[model samples]
Target: MADGERLASVTWLFGQPERDSVTEQAASPSQPTTADAPRGRHEPPTRAERASRAGEFQRINNVSMHALARRGMSVAEMRDYLIGREFDQHEADEECDRLLGVGLLDDFALAETLIRTLRQRKGLGRSGVTAELRRRRLENDAIEAALEDLDDDELARAIDLAERRAPQLRSLDTETATRRLSGFLMRKGYSSGVVRAAVDRALSRSGESSGPVFR
Candidate 1:
């Protein structure tokens, strides 16, 4: 793809910039204004209206921050959440910037924590974790950085996952066990090679004999 196309694809994930809602026009005191002048006749927002808008934004920000306090959220996730709650996109973006500035939202940190939790607690492989991160709309750099840590331990992790799930399949025949366990590992995002190896190891440990069942 061309550079422009690539950039477009990435930007498509976040949508377009929102238009500003409030527009202000200033008039010179010495200038003569006509009553029929569209520009002169229009009144700018009042101080109370501005304050009310500011308070609304603040309330939205506070609610979002409280949600973040309970658990980490990716910047895109928070922005989308605010937008879904009827906050203007520009205002939502401002709130996201403020939170990010204060370190309340860190995509890299969120990616790392999510990667660890998915792998250790949920037994998700690199592909599974990557898909999850993308679903959360994390930046590509953050996702790559988090996935870097999985390079050395993927096979071992796959084996461990298979081993843990091996017992339930022990009652099945060798072919059935191999098929079931291989499918399970594949669904967890293990590559065919890793799935085959893990299934072989798992079935062997369970005293079942099966040749390579995956290519």
Candidate 2:
């Protein structure tokens, strides 16, 4: 009877493992007892999984390219677009090449589109459009080509721009107005010679002489 009682005591003490023992085994470095494995959180994705994600990335870039073209993107404009979206250089370059290859992007076409848009909407001249195209990183050949198409349109717009802004130009004294008009036209992308000619023409049309004569 004493031995059976001792056996019962042994069973109660050690036969079932303690929860603390299980926890210590789990906390042990060599073996992980639970699927949760509590140490390393958010492990990096495997190579195959990364490859799958890269494919999805390319697909999304393709869609974004078409969407940008729909909004009238030139080569430089597209570069700016990708930069704005925080695309890495490699991805942005690849997308640029793909779009250019597929005819969805062209620098000359973009320059022409800008010229037309600015002429109708903003009343800008050839020099103004040329400056803008250059700012957009268009090739010299492309800029020249776009400017060729604006010969008549640009001259007319220049005249209108000068006429419309004449009051402000004339508000200054004649010498001041000449200087101010020159600066203004220069800011609008006109050459110094062109600005001088335009200023002379405007003054003559207003019944003022070629020399500095106050109104």
What is the TM-score of each predicted model, taking all chains together?
A: 0.71, 0.58
In the range 1-215, model 1's lDDT, one tens digit per residue, is: 99999999878765533212122123434445576456435678879979998998779878887889888999999998888988889988989999999999999999999988888898988888889999999989999988886657889999988887877765678888888889999898888998998888877765334422221
Weakest lDDT window of 10 consecutive positions for candidate 2:
205-214
State how far residue 1 of model 2 sits from its true place (Å): 56
- Computed on alpha carbons, the lDDT of every model, listed in order, comes to 0.82, 0.72
Backbone clash pairs in model 1 (N, Cα, C under 3 Å; residues 3+ apart or in different chains), count: 0
Q: How far in Å is the alpha carbon of 184 misplaced in model 1?
A: 0.7
Evaluated against the true structure, the overall lDDT of model 2 is 0.72
Provide C-alpha RMSD values for all models, in order: 23.7, 9.3
Per-residue CA lDDT of model 2 for 7-37, tens digit only, reads: 9999878946786688878688887557756
Task: Give the per-residue Cα lDDT of candidate 1 at 67.
Answer: 83
